[model samples]
Target chain A: MESVLEVKGLSKKYPSFELKSVGFHVDPGMVMGFVGRNGAGKTTTLKSILNLVHPDAGSVRVFGLDFMENEDVIKQQIGYAVGGVSYYNRKRICDIVAVTKMFYENWDDSEYKHYLNAFKLDENKKLKELSSGMKVKFYLTLALSHHAKLLILDEPTSGLDPVSREEITDIFTKLAQKGVAILFSTHITSDLDRCADSITYIKNGELMFSGNKSEFIRSYTESMGKVPSLEEIMVFIEKEEVVL
Target chain B: MGKLLKKEMKLTASPLSYWFILFSFMTFLPGYPILVGGFFVCLGIFFTYQQAVEYDDITFSALLPIRKKDVVKAKYAFVIIIQMISFVLSALFTVLRMTLLSEAKVYLVNQMMNANLFYLGFLLLVFAVFNTCFMKGFFKTAYRIGKPFIIFCIAGFLLIGVGEMLHHLPGMEALNSTSGTSLIQAFVLLFGIVIYVVQTLISMNSSERNFEKIDL
Candidate 1:
């Protein structure tokens, strides 16, 4: 398959929100930034893609296999991380890893230890005691150490300091270089400019833009008669009405 | 499923099982079976879904590779494990009491007694009722705290009411005797077992369907 992840015509309805015909794709060895404001259905879309949430319509395919039909086989090749690591909070980092590593058939112990050393993570500390940045690193380490070919991350660096954010961005790029497809959903536009090869913007549970990052910018520039960064465009979309 | 059970045991058994084992220190004393069995029954129903969602553990587990139904299945497996623990501890305590302190007659009193088949039946019936009430409310959404609480309270009150009424009845005292197991007692225990197995199957099926229809 050309794309490692493909979501087509996805739909879901909540009492107050809905994702209508939402679709996106990410090719191998590329990063697709899912950009949107808070409550814009970025997380919902990601969750549906990973089957964390059941969708009302459409389908998701990973590695050319139907996601719903081949959940185990498809998920074995995908590693998902939400905004933060939340599980067994009172357990030590190493203990949590020990329990979690058993779930993945291809868990690499040397890779896990290597990442721990590189990130300077203390294995003995309880998860509740770790800094938010360290928690993100721990999650990323788990995702990477499983030999996964795809990473679905929802706001992986949202609450981190600049140094941690930069470090995480570097890791995403490095993983992409190793032929891993990454679909990272974040509202922080600057993170995308640094690492995203393309952008998919969702607003009010709808896709407003999905294309080359430069082309998306140029379209807005031509329409508004001014060049705007992604952050400016997102703010304008939130604060004022604009045509996509 | 083995991996799923392993994860479930790691999450549910460690700390809770430790608490029960500590409680088992008083096992040789009478009422040991009822004590541990009651604790597990209450705890199993209470901890299934509401606690996980409240703690964001549901989100974490959903992000894992396991299917949604596997979560419900693991919980059923956990319940069986709880019952087995109660049984083993009860047997150990019963054997110890009989071997060491039979002359004291402390294990045969009305209020205090060693583990028996009747008590096992009572435990089974309680859990069977519990799963029926709880699985209905839990399958809707893991966050429906009020419904299951009300269900448990009603179940508890009814069982206690039955116990009180039996005390008032004249000939019912014979049912509590610690003599050879009776034919009627065997039938009651068999019925309780049937109910537990059937309710467990229904609970798993209902929960699987309920979870499938939900957004999360």
Candidate 2:
């Protein structure tokens, strides 16, 4: 299968934190779970791919295009959801939609309205006045309406209610059925187990594992004499300093 | 470039900023006649600078399908547009004020011509201000690096004061009546503009470098 996204030797440094060389690839029609603990450089990696944050070293490619050299072209095919729910404070939901529509050529108004109704979001309400869950729904609606081929989400379900989370998971499943490659970063392992085709683990800014989800689960179960949880596996890997 | 400019306009279309720009410009229309033109021009400059920094919108802007050069050009264009509008508004108000006061019409016209020249000078000053404020590491170390800008503005005010004092001298009056540009004056003006443009470009390059270094 052809890869939809690729990262190689990506690294970024700061005074307090450093993201070491991290690498991964997601094939078309695959849902890749990017599992990591808090501050594990998940957001940093997403930011690098989005070109919001530039890496000190290495490269990211989406749809076979260099992210930095072809950012404008790459971004058109990408649908990104930030970790938290934040938008222009004074802007109404409809206003946000209108502005986003201007930038994205493939924006589907009908899809946007459908998601708005599904999430029970008032199109006229200022984003700041909406609840955290509502804001997440709004962002998801915007992301889905863009007709993006690659979905890059950063902890998208962090603060959602179970019902909302299920809705989002279902949406992901529907998108995946259409062969949209997804890179979903989250600490919630249960969501990954339910939807992810493959899993990639990162710790201390380094890739620990990247393989099929079932294979990963089977390996951990055989080794530990129990059906180990993804989180548990992550902890074990970190403790052992496993490089694969 | 058009798309970027459109986005900028949309982002800044809030009623509060619109009124702020209007009120700032109108404040110059009827107040002290001596600085009437400078008042509007300065207000427009402050408005543009404040909006640029306040939105921190440039970070998001950099992600769009636009070149860095276009981004810089659009920002400069936005500032220039605002200044042009403020100039026309101030000029119209000045005309109405003089007509109401029954003042010498020709004198008002000449004063308006000088005001236009001052407007050009103000443009150079604004460019200088933006360069100094946004140049190397300025946004990263905003408050600390901004001290020099405040000092520069003060020095500018003092220099204008000195010019005013010199204007009252006997020889200076004759010098003002001369129409032909002195080579030295032309060189000084040209050099100032070149420096301002160079600094503007450097400031933009520094900002791009800073964006690359930021870890989001």
Candidate 3:
């Protein structure tokens, strides 16, 4: 299968924290769960791949193109959801969509309306007025409407209600079936249990494990001598990584 | 780049507040220096500069497919467009000032015709210096207002001081004469344009480089 995304030797340094040589890949038609504790380089890694942060040394390839060389072209086919930003607070939802639509080459207004209707969003509402869950829905709607081939979401499910989470998870499944690669970070491990085909777990700026989801769980069971839920497996892995 | 410009116009389009400032400023158009000076202050303080470093705008643009360099370019383009609007408005106000208050301010209109071309040139230089200063190290968006303002304040004062000295030169006829500006003032106007172009180019290059290194 052709990989939709690839990160190699990605490293970023900060005053108090450093993301040291982390790497991973996600193929087309696959949904990869990016699991990490708070400040474990999940957002940093994502930002690096997006070139939001200039990495100290690394290469990021998306759709077989070096992201730095073909950033504009590659980004057109990718949707990034950094949830619940209070950008343009004075602008209405309709205005935001209008402006954002012009940025993408393949923005679908009809598809956007369908998501707005399905999500029960009011286009006239200001961004400041939307609840956290509603904001995530808005971001997702923006991503999906752009006809993006790959969706990269950063902690999009954190404040969402259970029902909204389920709804979005369903949308991800549908997107993946349509051959849209997905890589989302979520603390809600159960969301992944039903959706993610692969998992990459990170801790303190290191990848603890990156492979098939079931194999990750089975590795935990084999090492710890018992089966555990995904969340339990995460805690065990972090603990083991710390001990090592 | 056109797409980048389009996105920038959309981002800066704060319908009410934006128009409100323009309307209010136009209502009280002042002399050459004050009119254009007020325009920059209002735009910098109330809109573009604030918007330039906005956390949300930065984050939002990062999600778009455009190059990091284009983001900086688009920002510069927006400021330039705002300056162009001010130019158009100033020209109209000059006409209104000359026609409506013709007899009372004959000198102002005369200045508009000849030597006062220096005013437009000076304003462009001031705005370029101001934006260039503000955009350098822009990623450190917070607590940076004072530095650039101070630098621009000195530039403003220096320009005034130089103009004052030039006005007193021995060969100079009265600066307020109805005939037109002297040859020296024309040279000064050309000089201002030179500085504007060179400074703006330097600023654009540096801002692009600094922004790429910034951890957004």
Candidate 4:
């Protein structure tokens, strides 16, 4: 398989918004940062790829296998973490894991225990008792414990403190080093700068760019006649569009 | 599907649902509208779905290595199990009312629906209506429960009212008999079981389709 994840011709329409043929691909061992402004269709595109939101038109391939046709098999190899995963506030972490681990045949109890200990997570704690950062760690722990070859995280670091964000990005870097392909959506460009090997930018439900992070930066410098941080490029484009 | 069903039972189901099975004993209550027992049992199952939504259970299930339709299937399975358990309890009380309490004056003179084989049939009808109306309506949005549940309450109670009124009709008094079963009572019981099975299967199919359109 050339790409760990590939999405093409993705489209969906709402009364007020439309995602028009968005496309992107992530190669194996690559950390691809999906960037977009609020309501820019980042979540929609990610959901479409996962078939959470049925795309009006598109095809998604994961590990070179058709996603829809081989959904169960494909999903087994993918670790999907939604932004704010609060499951049953009254249930303890071990109880939740007890229910979750049954679905995966390759569930690694030892790996789960390792992530639990490494993250300093108390398995006895209820979901409501955990802080926001701890919840993120817990979700990552679930995602990583199943021997996933691909990780798709939606806003994993949003609403987190700088320390927590740094910690998560560090984990992402290490995972990428171990050949686990990751596609993470975030508003935090700094996290991407720290770990992203490639970038995919969306604006108003359209694909603006999808390529090497340095190449995206170089393209912006050549056109604007100035070096710009990833954050600046995003802001500059949105601001420039309003001027037009 | 087995794993998903396990998740539904161990994770999403509420303890109140199991407790609500006791509602079947309302059959032993003299002169009261025992039909409401079936409605209360369904209400308990409704709480499970309500809690699932509050806890973002759909999103969690979506993240699992299973189809969205399988999530609906598991919920329906859990619901059927609860409903059947309630039905069995209600049937046991119905048998006692017919055999042991047949001559009890309070029951003999009761103007409401009697706990008999015919009543068992109507109880199944009540569950059938609940599964059809409530399950289909909830899956349309995959989140809202209040409206669908209210709709079920109306349908279920209306069925009970009809079941009670049938015994008052000039030629339908056999339906109110608290003793040995007649051919008509046996037929009604069989019919009720069929309706429960068929209606639930049809509702399950539509619910799975409606849930597929929902973007969790």
Candidate 5:
């Protein structure tokens, strides 16, 4: 199957930090986990692909079409659920949704209502009233309601409890099974191990690895001469770098 | 674009902005510098921008299925809509002052800028200055509102002072006319419209380009 998203040589430079030539791809029905420590350029990479930040160098293609040239069309099929940014904190959930739904041609109101019910979200409640975990679910609801083919989530399960994380991971697994590609960034490797089919690791603005999840684990296990979990592999590599 | 405009009016805008349009009624004040009425209208729109920043509205809009340019366009359209509503109100009040209240003692003896077509034109110029300065500066980073707003206030008030000073000039006495409209007043209103349109369009395009480079 053709890839749902392709990013090539994406580069962005800031005064104090720079994102190097980063690239990755996600296929339909695949869940790709983007892993990195803080300040590893994961957010920058995602922003560049979404055109929230203009890339200094490189190209991003969504469904084999140039992202910049076909941004509106591509964005329509992509659901982006960023973790921390809040929208209209003073407005009720229903009010914000009423404004948001008008922009999408394929908005599925029944699906939205279904997710709202499943998540136990109160439509009359202001966004500020929702807890952080609930806020993530709310963003996910907005993302899923429009029938997005690709979901780009930034740290969707960062601060959640283990049970909440499990619930979100189960949701991801089901979505991938339904042929929706998901690329999510997270520091929680356990979540990736649970649901991700592929893993892309970044270190200090550079791509350390990007491939099948088991292959990544196998490569690390062979090099270290023992079986290791995804979290162990990440910790071991990061510690080794610190020692070196 | 229409959808984006709806987003601005419904989601991002402050409700205080609508209430501020009532500031145009200040033209009915007897001896006050009625140009401050226009400033209040712009202040209302400024509050919307302030509220948008607090709500992270820019990032939210960036995530929508719209171009960065469309976001800037929607804001400019919102500003214009608010301004035009206030403008129409000021116009109605100016007509009232020039007609039924034309012979009222307070308006007749007021030494400040009289409620006239020239006042309407100067008000548009005030909005033009604000839009050109504020939009250009704000979009450079899309978050810094303080500096741009201060600069616009200086420019806006300077224009207001100049508008007040014009009638005192020997050849421009018709600018403060209360009872009758002059050819000069018509020309001033025409000139203000041209400036407002051209300035807003150029500055909006510049702001769109600036915003395209911002990383939300």
Candidate 6:
């Protein structure tokens, strides 16, 4: 099966933190949960794939195209949502939508409007005036409206209420049913269990596991004598330095 | 390229900076000379560019379906747009002054032309400064260097002032007078264009290298 996204040997170094060689891939029709700690390089990895942060060494291919060489084409097929999802403080929500619509060729205004209404967001409100959760909803609406084949979400559900999160999960599940791949990054294991088809865990900038969700959970259940949470498994891996 | 252009335009369409620039440019009117206009123009460019470079927006911008070259091109286009707007507005005010006051049209024209040249030089300098300071992962450095940069610019203006004061001493008048001639004016115009092109290329190369090296 063709992979929707492939990352290999991605490394980045900073004065205080270093993302060691990390690699992973997500096949089509899969919701790959990217689990990591607060500073475990998850955001950095996503940034690398989006060409937001330059990888010191390695390659990222999305939709069978080199990310750097074919960035525009890759971006066209990918939807991205960062943690905070900030917008111009002075712009009305509709204006922000309009600006985004102009850049994305596949933007669906009807879908965007529907999501805006679904989220109970006022089109006239300035972005700065919206609550943090509302901003995430707005970003998700924008991401979905672009007809993106892959959704790269970085802590997208962090601040949402359970109801809102469920609504968003339904959106992802629907998109996945239609064969859109999703790389949903979060520390929330329960959310991944609810929505992800597969799971990919990263620790200290290395892939810990990448496989079927049920099998991974079963394995953890068997080994730990209870179903270990994703966070526990990550801690175990870090303590033991488990390669697999 | 079109996508890049569109994105750049959208990014700049946020009206706050645009309005601020318009107001800053407008403040150079009524009784102000060309130096005030030039100062305001420089301030406007600095503020606008500085605001754009804040945070991960540049990273978000790089993530769009645009090439590194297109990113550089769009930035160049943005600079040109801002410069053109400020130039046009300043020219309009100068025209207003010429029409109403009627005493200093010739002096104002010459001063306006000189102001244009100074601005052209200022633009090149600012581009180079932005590239070396902000574009290459040195935004903090840029901010720090900015104070000294402004000091140096003031010092340079002071030297020009001193040179003007010495115009009566020797051959300085001849040099200043020749600066207004058709041939000399053409040379200055061409020099400005060449400098802009060269600085833009330098900025592009620097940005490309910076993008390549960035560990997003």
TM, every model: 0.90, 0.78, 0.86, 0.96, 0.96, 0.79
Task: Give per-residue lDDT, candidate 3, residue B162.
Answer: 54
Which candidate gets the maximum DockQ versus the true structure?
Answer: 5
How do the residues B1-216 of candidate 2 rate in per-residue lDDT, one tens digit apiece?
667666656663344334444532432232223333333344445544455555445554565555544655565555545545654565455344434532534444332222222333343544455445533444443223346446545645554454334434666442222232444334434664676667766666666555455544
| Clashing residue pair totals per candidate (backbone < 3 A) | 0, 1, 0, 0, 0, 5
lDDT of 5 by residue, B7-103 (tens): 9999989989999999999999987889999999999999999999999899889989888789999999999999999999999999999999898
Of candidate 5 chain A, the 10-residue stretch with the lowest lDDT total is A235-244
- Docking tier of model 1: it is medium
B-chain TM-score, candidate 2: 0.55
Clashing pairs in 2: A208-A244
Model 6, stretches more than 4 Å misplaced? Answer: A235-244, B13-33, B54-56, B88-169, B174-197
**For residue B62, what is the lDDT in candidate 1?**
61
Q: Compute the lDDT for candidate 6.
A: 0.65
| lDDT of all predictions | 0.74, 0.64, 0.72, 0.90, 0.91, 0.65
Q: What is the fraction of true interface contacts found in candidate 2?
A: 0.29
DockQ of each: 0.58, 0.31, 0.57, 0.76, 0.77, 0.41
Error of 3 at A202 (Å): 0.8
TM-score of predicted structure 2, chain A: 0.90
Query: Positional deviation of A107 in candidate 6, in angstroms?
Result: 2.4
Give the CAPRI class of candidate 3.
medium
lDDT of 5 by residue, A193-235 (tens): 8999999999989999999999999999888889899999988
By TM-score rank, best first, the candidates go 4, 5, 1, 3, 6, 2
Where in model 5 is the C-alpha error above 4 Å?
Answer: A240-244
Per-residue C-alpha lDDT of model 3 across residues B61-152, encoded as one tens digit per residue: 76687777787788777666666666556545544544554455434443222224444456566566666665553534422556666666
For candidate 3, the clash count comes to 0
In model 2, the Cα lDDT at residue B119 comes to: 30
Residues A1-244 of candidate 3: C-alpha lDDT, one tens digit per residue = 6689998999988899999898889999899999988889999999899988889988999999999999889888898886555667666899888888888889998999998998899999988789877887888888889888889999878877888788778878888998999999876798898789999888889888888998999888877788889989877666654454
Top lDDT: which candidate number?
Answer: 5
TM-score for candidate 3, please give it.
Answer: 0.86
